[model samples]
Target: MADLKVGSGEDIIITSGLGSCVGVTLYNKSTKIGGMAHVMLPEFPANREQGNPAKYADTALDMLLDKLRKKRVNLNRLEAKMAGGAQMFNFSSSNDKMRIGARNIEAVERILQEKGIPILGAEVGENYGRTMELHNATGKVLIKTVKHDDIVL
Candidate 1:
């Protein structure tokens, strides 16, 4: 796991091996300011509390938004792009309790929608893992899957 940090207008953020995890990249086209959060869970953790709030999906969205706002990047002018939600493991049980990837993807979409951010593109929900890069300067997202190599969006 790379050091997850919020980036400014001229920075680039990247993450790798997004299996059953969601990577959300929020960027402002006008200012080229952005942040990328790799959230493992959809919501806040029950077992632990009161640490780095930016490590969770729900709180990370708010934290990143606040940082961008301070930089004069309006939420309304921002665009979101997501990647990585893979059903990487196969379970023997017939129970429908192991849909972590789908759940994470749903949670990310819902949070972005609630925050009034537009989704420019997304590549999610497959059996393969992905490595993603968010270019802050252009709001251009590049995704590379295990089999497909590199794809630019």
Candidate 2:
């Protein structure tokens, strides 16, 4: 997770070449604090974070929120935006893991709802890759996809 804490000033964080990967940003407007994570899996083995929390959605979010809390950011004021959960490739494989992209998005959304953090915006789930940028100054997410026009959320 990448974080710009209180008094850190305006900073933009980005993750490029996302495929079957989700980039989630959490921000507190009042504190001007924000964090982003490049999530590869919806959940970890047994859903445990172990060492690298950023490797999974659930653990990554936990780590991010803890960081924000340490910076004195109000959890109640937190808003979330996400992007880049593309299918990435085509295969006839029936394995559920092959659908990791969609599952990653689902896990993220579920976690947000459970934490009472509203999803302000999202650009997810397609057959193409995406790159996402989080603007800490405005809490706006910029998404660029190969097959679709760029979008801001």
Kindly report which residue stretches of model 1 are placed more than 4 angstroms away from their true locations once superposed. Answer: 1-3, 94-97
lDDT tens per residue, model 1, 11-38 = 7889998988888888877777888888
Each model's backbone clash number: 0, 0
Total backbone collisions, model 1: 0
Compared with the true structure, the alpha-carbon lDDT of candidate 2 equals 0.82
With candidate 1 superimposed using the best TM-score fit, by how many Å does residue 38's alpha carbon deviate from the native? Answer: 0.7
CA deviation > 4 Å runs, candidate 2: 1-8, 47-51
RMSD of 2: 2.6
| lDDT of each candidate versus the true structure | 0.81, 0.82
TM-score, each model? Answer: 0.88, 0.89
Residue 49 Cα positional deviation in candidate 2, in Å, after optimal superposition: 8.4
